[model samples]
Target: MAVKIYGIKNCDTMAKARHWLEARGVEAVFHDYKALSIGQDVLEGWADRIGWQKLINTSGTTFRKLPDEDRADLDEAKALRLMQAQPSMIRRPILDTGDQLIAGFKPDIYENVFK
Candidate 1:
């Protein structure tokens, strides 16, 4: 199946991922999470496949900007709610290669998976 990359268009990592896929001539369907809000079921499905921990980008500004209470004692349900509300809280370039769900952009990982 073709790759479906879930990320914002302006993200630097997303740019690299797009370039890498284009260079390899791989078909990529970019699901811009900003433009297209991900459904709860769809997001939950990803979490089920990869785990909610992987879906939440703790290092991103979105997560950091959260109220201290939100960040202090987080759990799966709370994290999922936050991510659903703000896609930016999700890690960049979540790759869906049909069989697996990859949460972030890693050149070496992408090369190994797709090449």
Candidate 2:
């Protein structure tokens, strides 16, 4: 399967994920969403597959720094707008493994997916 790992390059989680993939010899392409913005349609598609709640990284500094108004009463539309404006607020290292979208880095999960 063609795997694509999407995230900001500087993120710590992303670094770990990349390292793990490399160590495992998993051939995957890295997409720097910070430099090249992720599209609204693409985000929408991901949201469709796995709800916006999972795609968003509320615990991250980017999201925590967001104004109270932006964080309040989130729906798909509002969340998408926030994510589009600040890609960093979207969770780190979303691995697209052709057949599935995996959010965040977990060794067990990666092993299962690749195996």
The candidate maximizing lDDT is 2
What is the per-residue lDDT of model 2 for residues 5-67, given as tens digits with 9 covering 90 to 100?
A: 999998889999999999989988999999999999999999999899999999988999989
lDDT of 2 at 85: 95
lDDT of 1 at 104: 89
User: TM-score of the candidate numbered 1?
Assistant: 0.95
Q: Write down the worst ten-residue block by lDDT for model 2.
A: 1-10
Which runs in model 1 stand beyond 4 Å of their true positions? Answer: none
lDDT by residue (15-104, candidate 1, tens digit) is 999999999998889899978888889889998999999999999998998889999888889988999999998898899999878988
Clash count (model 2, backbone only): 0
Q: Please, what is the TM-score per model?
A: 0.95, 0.96
Error of 1 at 20 (Å): 0.5
lDDT for model 1, please.
Answer: 0.90
Q: What is residue 94's positional error in candidate 1, in angstroms?
A: 0.5
